[model samples]
Target: MSQTNIPLLSLKNISKQFFGSTVLENINFDLYPGEVHAIFGQNGAGKSTLIQIVTGDIQPSSGKIILNNEELKIHSVHKARELGISAVFQEFSLVPQLTVEENLFLGSNNTKGFFLDKKKLHQMACQTMEQLEFSIKPEEKIINLSHAEKRMVEIAKAFHTKPSIMVLDEPTASLAENETNQLFSMIEILKKEGIGVIYITHRMKEIYKISNRITILQDGHVVNTDSVSNINEQKLVELATGRNITNLFPEIKKQRGKKLLDIKNLHISNSFIEDVSINVKAGEVIGITGLAGSGKSAIGRACFGVNKIEAGTISYLDDVIFDSSKQINDISPRAMLDRGMLYLPSDRRAEGLIMEQNIRENISLPSLGLPKFSNGFIVNRKIEKDIVEKIGE
Candidate 1:
């Protein structure tokens, strides 16, 4: 094949609208074989919308999608998969109750007769796991797997399709550094096999490391597309945000105050945390770093009332929030929030926000029952709108 040949996948003049509002406009993108094409943008920059159109989850209002120089009319996800396109979205679609093998071949049409060939399925699943360097067992249930393990299974499932074009949206958001390296290695193997990978991520470092070409999107339009070497990180950020980001991280010089939170001899039953002690001062920032299964996240959960503290003393600014020595009931999450202690869960979609609710509803959820936003049991529309707008700002 010549370098001047048709692209493996070409999106020409793609535009999408929702309820008369343009979400994507005249977007032209291409994915070439054996190359990793990265799509970069800020939040609501139409990155997900563009990906949905490609995966047949949403149809574009105007444009043509060419696959191997032929215009393709992708009506559904099944059709896209059948036409050698596969995607591993950020939110995994695995059935938690199903085994790894079952989830891997759940929607596949490769079985013979009415009965499922367990032996064949196991063999194929094992082969795919081996190819992707995944370490989970085929018989393991997804519910019992860790976040990183589930992410690996999702990737393995997508790779098992043997698609010529692959789309990975924020694949490493939940993965650790070592796990991310493993995924990058797998991407290299795919590239060698002439698979065109469309990688979407907000991390700037990964783009330079894994992508051959970069496409920046701003306000539902393609700002620029160029070779990785042709654009520096600063220039790339500027293009995506449409502004000169001179200092991405400004210097902070603030004096610390008295201890605000004090955790003493903390222990979570049947978990990794044991006899841990920590203190946080007001106006101070702290970071927790450890291996994937470490008790770092557990500490946050315990402090936020998500995990029970079997033995500990949690004092907030001289006030005893939780004292395991006392025979009292555990504090609820609502109580902690009412005390002005909010915990932002790592899994935003599942715990932090309601996915089905709109932005206004999500923002007002915490204060729904408050007197300022609700009269008796009815919500004050003006107050709710004002609260959302203030929080959004």
Candidate 2:
């Protein structure tokens, strides 16, 4: 049978429940070889849950998975990969201590006699990265690389598996415009190679650019599945959110306060950024854009005192906190936080949030010892919960 006649994978009546709460209800989806199927949904709309079940990260409460027209019961991510299902999600699945080459073949049994051929693995990693069109060092440790570089390594790891079905969740979330273009090119290549792809992204343009079909999920139900050409961006948004785009983001007006931050002649140590300057007002939103590894994040990290500043002047509220010329660089993250400045890193799993902690705990961490959430190191659970709930609202 041809690839179009027979689906590469299918899910029938897939239902998932966590502690009596239904996540996915009677979900049915399919992918054909060489097809780019885009899954669209709002947060908690069961998109991630369905993908997790397909890739074996989570099991469905009741369902049937058919792979190549045969029953499939994927119980683990590793087993899924071995069975020609590879995935790279927003949360990177990489060992921080391991090098890129090691991470690429981390769980695979591509060795003999219970020993790994490190040299061969390095060569293979080099070729794989090249094939993916990513400029990353195979010997570099995941922890030492920047957020974008780490994302590239994750993409390379998934692509190296040579899987029949590849899952990419927010692949361009950490990537630059040029990097995103490269990824789109890679997707075209995958389509030609007859590899089915399950893409999950929020970028509306990507749906028409790469995906052949789109499936929208809303409140644990399959809202609709149709060809990309059949749906417009506004229609997709309405279906996914159950509201018009205008209702989702209503117009709001705010008065601009005095200059809040000013960066001039910024230069990051060991990076290519130099002679960069930016000014931000209280109500203004500043966006930094460039190619991957172009120091877009370097500027933010420098302001937060995470990256070393070779030469720069960072002024907060007209006070020079980081001035390389005056040797006045005694700033730290804690000091900035104490000054009412909070910095949220790009990598949530590695930096922003504590993965082991619950959502309430993570949100309450910043104010753990503060008067609102605690009293003299003793936490006030009720008060903290109220404040967190209010913040959520």
Clashes of each: 0, 0
In candidate 2, what residue range of length 10 has the lowest lDDT sum? 243-252
List candidate 1 segments past 4 Å from native: 1-4, 326-330, 353-361, 372-393
lDDT of each: 0.89, 0.87
Which lDDT tens digits does candidate 2 get at residues 186-233?
Answer: 888778878899999989999899999999999999999999999998
For candidate 1, the TM-score is: 0.91
Residue 40's C-alpha lDDT in candidate 1? 97
Q: How does candidate 2 fare on TM-score?
A: 0.84
RMSD of 2: 3.5
Q: For candidate 1, what is the lDDT?
A: 0.89
Error of 2 at 155 (Å): 3.7
